[model samples]
Target: MNLILLYPEEVQASGQILSLKDRRFQHIAQIHQPQIGDRLRAGLINGPIGEVEVLALSASEVQLRWHLAAAKPSPDALPLELVMALPRPKMLKRVLQTAATLGVKSLWLIHSYRVDKSYWSTPVLSPDSVHEHLCLGLEQAGDTLLPQVHLRKRFKPFVEDELPALVAGRRALVAHPYQAQDCPAPAWQPSVLVLGPEGGFIPYEIAKLQEAGVESVSLGSRILRVETALPVLLTRLFPLR
Candidate 1:
């Protein structure tokens, strides 16, 4: 893990010292093999980046004191919301982590024509599982801000009623291979990107999205999996500032 993420409740009464005896402690003890007085990169969830000095270590736990007063600023969050068709159980885990790692602050998981009904019942959608994967992503990127996820189970109601307003005043785009404009140049602007399921959105769905102010865009002839396409579309739309 690039950063040891500490939760708000982990703070001791002094507000400076925190302890870990969970997976994080195991990761530190096994991966880092830290020494007393050695400092490691850390940050508070949705807070600033800082260093935590190792005060004590044991096989089961570790105690750390933060220098939060001198903490650095966290990375800038992306001004984008990802609206994706819920993938299968396995892909869902990766997607959550990938989206969080890439700084997507908002996500709307929606239903599409090709999406399997069984996919919705997966345990990966549980609050705990989602939170865990997102944390893993944050740890990988040394990020602290957690992304918000929304679920829309009905396709028609969401597209016809809610989507237009969501896309309004934003650079909204739907990634479709057919009859689509080439993806636009990278720019830092508020945007909403709609992605489809494995076989892509049906023509009728694309039309509904277009009517809702979402322009269809393409990344050329090669069809990419959802995992590959997400990062490409995000980077192509908004490069690092």
Candidate 2:
């Protein structure tokens, strides 16, 4: 982990001291193996990035002094919302982590025609499981702001009832292979990116998205997997300076 993520609740009652005994402790004890006076890069979830001075360290737990006054704000979040067809469980884990790492503040995982019904029943979708993977992503990126993930089980209802408002004033683009315009210039403004399932969205679904104000766009002739397409599209939509 590039940044040691500390939750607000984990802080001691004094607020300036924090203690960790979870996997983070294991990581620090094993990987960092720092002396008592050493400081480590750390951030509070949805808070600031700063250093934590090791006050005490042991096999069971590690105590640190939180330097909130010296902390800096986390990186600005991308002004984009990612709407994606829920991939299978295995791919879902990677997608969640990648989305978080890329600074996507909002995510919608919806059903698509090609999406397997069995995929919904996987344990990876559980709240705890999702939080863990997202944290992994945040730790990798040294970011603290957690992305909000919305789940939609019904495709038609989501498109017809909810999607229009979601894309009302934002530039919405749905990635499709057939008869699609090339991905537009890097959009720094508020936008929505819709990605389809393994085989891509069916014609009717694409039409529905179009009706909802999501224009069809393509990432060239080479069709990519959902996991591969997501980061590529996001990077193109909002490239880092």
Candidate 3:
């Protein structure tokens, strides 16, 4: 990993000391091959960027001491938010990682008519697993800020009860492949884009989203998987910014 992440508990009275027994230890020892006194970039989750010196190493673990560095710059204040239909477990990991890499500020794992109920119960939904995926994204992009992720289990209530406030004062677009206008390229204002499941949104779901101020948009005639569609949509919607 580019910037090794540390937990709050890992920080010692002497500053930050991470146990090499952690997964990151393996990453460093195997991939990075850092030597004692060697410095590496590191960060606390949702916190500052800093440097860590490899102080000691062993067969079982490694020890690190951190030197406080400048606080990481805040991520861009993009108006774009993603409300994505829950994909399969494997795809979920990729989606979260990709979204994190692209600098999405917030992500909602949304439920829709086409979504499989079982997907929500996957172990990948656990906080630790989610954080792992996000960490990979951060390392890939050399970014330290973590995106906020929200899970919506009920489709109708989320749409009828919560979506309005979430979309307040911003444009909302729902991506569906059938009978919709083309998806617009990224614009200057903040926008909330809702993507449907692999099979696409049902008519009733689309109607409810529209009632909640979402405009239906298409990504041309060819239907794409949720993973493929998400990056394409984000790039198109936020090309220059």
Candidate 4:
């Protein structure tokens, strides 16, 4: 982990020595192997970025002084919200991590006709599982804020009822293979991007999104997997950010 991420509840009081015994402790002992007086980069989730000075180390735990006075604001997240058709369980884990690492502050995982209903029942969708994946991403990026994930299991109701409100007054784009315009250039404006499953969204789904004010955009001739398409799309959409 590039940054040690601690939640508020983990540290009961400020200015006190904190002990870590979780995966972070294992990482410090095995990977970092720092001597006393050495400081490691650390951050509090949704809080500040700083460091922890090693006070002592043992097999069971590592004690550190939480010198967070130098803590600064976390890096800004991308000014975009992602709307995606949920992929299978295995792909979901990687997608979640990539989205978080790339600074997507909000994610909407919804159902499309091609999406398998069984995929929703996977343990990866559980709150703990999602948090674990997101934390891994934050640690990799040295970021403090956790991305929000919204689940919508119904396709028709979500597109017709909720999506319009979600995209109101925002530049919305839906990735499609046919009848699509070239993807727009990256900008700082607020935007909502909708992408589809492994095979891409069905025609009717695209139509509904278009009716809801989302324009259709294309990547290319070749179809891409959900995992591959997501990072590619996000990077293209916010290339400079």
For model 3, residues 27-72, the per-residue Cα lDDT tens digits are: 8899889879998887766766777889998877988887775446
Q: Against the hidden reference, what TM-scores do the models get?
A: 0.96, 0.95, 0.89, 0.95
Cα lDDT, model 3, residue 141: 66
lDDT, candidate 1, 1-241, per-residue tens: 9999988777633338777999999999999999999999898898778888999998789999987755787788999879999999999999999999999999999999999999998999999999999999999988999999999999999999998888988999999988989999998988999999999999999999999999999988899999999999999999785
TM-score leader: 1
Evaluate model 2: give its TM-score: 0.95
lDDT of 2: 0.89
The candidate that achieves the highest lDDT relative to the unseen native structure: 1
Return the candidate ranking by TM-score, descending: 1, 4, 2, 3
Task: Name the 10 consecutive residues with the lowest summed lDDT in model 1.
Answer: 8-17
Query: What lDDT does each candidate get?
Result: 0.91, 0.89, 0.82, 0.88
Off by over 4 Å in 3: 12-16, 74-78
Model 4 TM: 0.95
**TM-score of candidate 3 versus the correct structure, residues matched by position:** 0.89
lDDT of model number 3: 0.82
Predicted candidate 2, C-alpha RMSD? 1.5
